[model samples]
Each structure stands twice: as C-alpha cells, then as structure tokens.
Target: MTLAFDSAGLGPGFADPVFDSQSVFRSVLNAVAYPGAIERLAHRPGAPEGLDPAMASVVLTLCDLDTPIWSDAALSSEAVSTYLRFHCGAPLVAAAADARFGLIGDAAAMPRLDAFAMGDERYPDRSTTLVVTVPSLTEGPQRQWSGPGILRRRTVAVAGLPDWFWADWALNQGLYPLGVDVLFACGDAVMGLPRGITVKE
Candidate 1:
C-alpha cells in the first residue's frame, strides 16, 4: 500500500516520506535495558498532527498484520488510522482485551490498566502492551519503581496521568507474569515498564 503522506496534511519541513523504524526499535531496547532513564527519540518531523513522531516511530517499528492495535479515541481518525493500516499493516481491534498493542495517543484518555489484556497463566507473554504518549518526558512527582530492568528503586514523576493508573499498576505487580507492559513516549524519546516492575507508593 502506498501512503500519501505528502497530502496527509502534515506540517511543512517533514523529510523522509517514509521513516526508518528499526532505529526506534533499537532505542526501545536501550530504554528497556536501563529502566528509569529516558531514552533519546529520533523521528522525521511533520508527521500527521494527531500522530507524534515518537508514537509514529514506535508504530512503525512494531506493528504488522499479526499485531492487533487499539487506538485512543483522540487519534481514531480515518486519515491517521488508514495511514497506520496501510503503512504498518496493523489490524485495528474493537476490544482492548483483544489488542496486542494499545496506542494511547492521549494519556488522559487511557483506560484503567486492568481493563487491558493481561496474559493468562498458561501464556503469560500474551498480554497487551500499552503505548502511552505524554506531553512531557521530564521527571514529575516521583514514584518508586523497581523490577528486572531496574538496577535499584528509581523515582519517576510522570505527567498526564490520573491517580487510578498508579493504583492499578500497584495491583498489577502482584499478578506477576499475568499483567500488561507499558511504553511511554514523549517527543522522540521512549521508556518501558514490564509487568515485572514493582511500583511503590
């Protein structure tokens, strides 16, 4: 499928009509390797208005026909959705529980973490992955984080989140392997929290 990115109404000065997604994938690995540290983001500017370069980069890197995606209501537009379908070949999902990748373009609109798919005991790796795009990446009101990816307990103050997610995240930690993972994107930077993360209030 050919994407008419030029006519998609993206802003001026966006070069490289099609972005190379492998770079972002590699960056994701680095981010996961060192939890609590922000990983630098890189993307071609001028992506469609609703779709940030960082979010788009992740979509490109991970999406395929096998991946079922659930887009946030904020970015559930025909143009953006169609572009993703054509470019990434990702199948849109009607139910969050059925989605392998849930794209939360607006952090505020994100559903409760428990509402998403947490893998079953038989296949703990089958859980959904949330891709949350926040307005800022800087450390906000710090919260403790510790797990496999972390060297020690780290503090992160994130923006654009409600009180309930932290509560849900805290609960999810007890579920062990039967929980969802998360990836946070801001600008071109990305970070991750696997189900293993033990968050402390």
Candidate 2:
C-alpha cells in the first residue's frame, strides 16, 4: 500500500525514505530471526517526544495505512497520535485488542499480553505485534530462551517490566502458533520475543 504523504501535517520521517526504511527493516528482520538477540536500530525519524527511538524506527519501517496502532498511556499523547497519523497514515485504535501494532511506553502499566489481538485459530499470523519501550535490555531477571530463532538456548534479561509479565508470557507461549509477539526496545536496540520462544526462568 502507498504511504500517505503529508507535506505539512506531521514531522518528517527518513531523510532518504527508501534506503533508510530498508536499513531499519533489515534490523527488524534480524531481531525476529534471532529472538532475544538485540539488533541495533537504524534510521533517525523525527519521532514524537515520548516515542522511543527504536520503536519509532520500527513503526516507520513496518507500519502503513493498513495497520492499526494502539498506544499505551505513556505514548498516547496528542503529539504522538498526530505524528503517527501524518507519517504512517495508520489508524489509531482506542482498544488494544483491535490493534495490529501496539506501541507501549510504560511496561509497568501496559495491558496484559492476552489483551491484544491473538488472531484466529486459522489465521494465526494476524496477531498483534507489541513494540514496548523499556529501561534496560540486560538488567532484569534472567530467563533461558529457546525456540526457532535461538541456536540452542539464550539467557535474556529485560528490565522495567511488571512482576506478572512473565506469567502472561508463559500463557501466551503456551498458545503455540496462535499468540501475540513482542519486540522489546531499549534506547536504539530491539529484541524479539516471538510466541514460539520458550522462556525458562
């Protein structure tokens, strides 16, 4: 789909749109290809004040008019809404369950994983992809992660999450091919936590 162009409504995105988006898209692919492995984000979009750099880059690279977005309390500011609308032309949804992409800035208060779209049994790929911004990538409880993307098993620690997050992850993972996937962003780095990944605490 063609991205809606706005000359005056939103802040500018990539300087070199095609090349820059390709670069960021590569990073996003790598993140999902190697779950729990941090991929350095590329591009420097003129993101809104509260939007995280990595999440913003990912949104610009992956989102379009077809995707609907949901923003958490910390990221639902008017500036962010206007920016995303103008740059991405994506519909902003009020309910988390309806969003194809959820931008979360407050991990502690974000909705549970099950609250978002889990897709249908037949079209499991229709699930939501959460892009959550946290404080650190390596300063939380360590858990052993293993799945399609992992070589054998990888130990990962993510900071700035609520205590119940892992419990939600466990349940989400139990859904096998039908569940929500997550992209954890810290600073300018992103790490994937696909539904296939098993986390052993």
- Give the winner by TM-score: 2
Task: Please give the lDDT score for candidate 1.
Answer: 0.78
TM-score of each: 0.88, 0.93
- Candidate 2's C-alpha runs over 4 A off are 1-10
Candidate 2 overall Cα lDDT vs. reference? Answer: 0.89
Q: Score residue 96 of candidate 1 by CA lDDT.
A: 92
**Candidate 1 residue-wise lDDT at 172:** 89
How many pairs of residues collide in model 1? 2
User: What is residue 97's positional error in candidate 1, in angstroms?
Assistant: 0.7
Please report, in order, the local distance difference test score of every candidate based on alpha carbons: 0.78, 0.89
lDDT of 1 by residue, 43-162 (tens): 544456688777777777788999999988988887777767766778998899999999998887688988888999899988898889887766556788887878778887677876
Clash statistics: count for each candidate: 2, 0
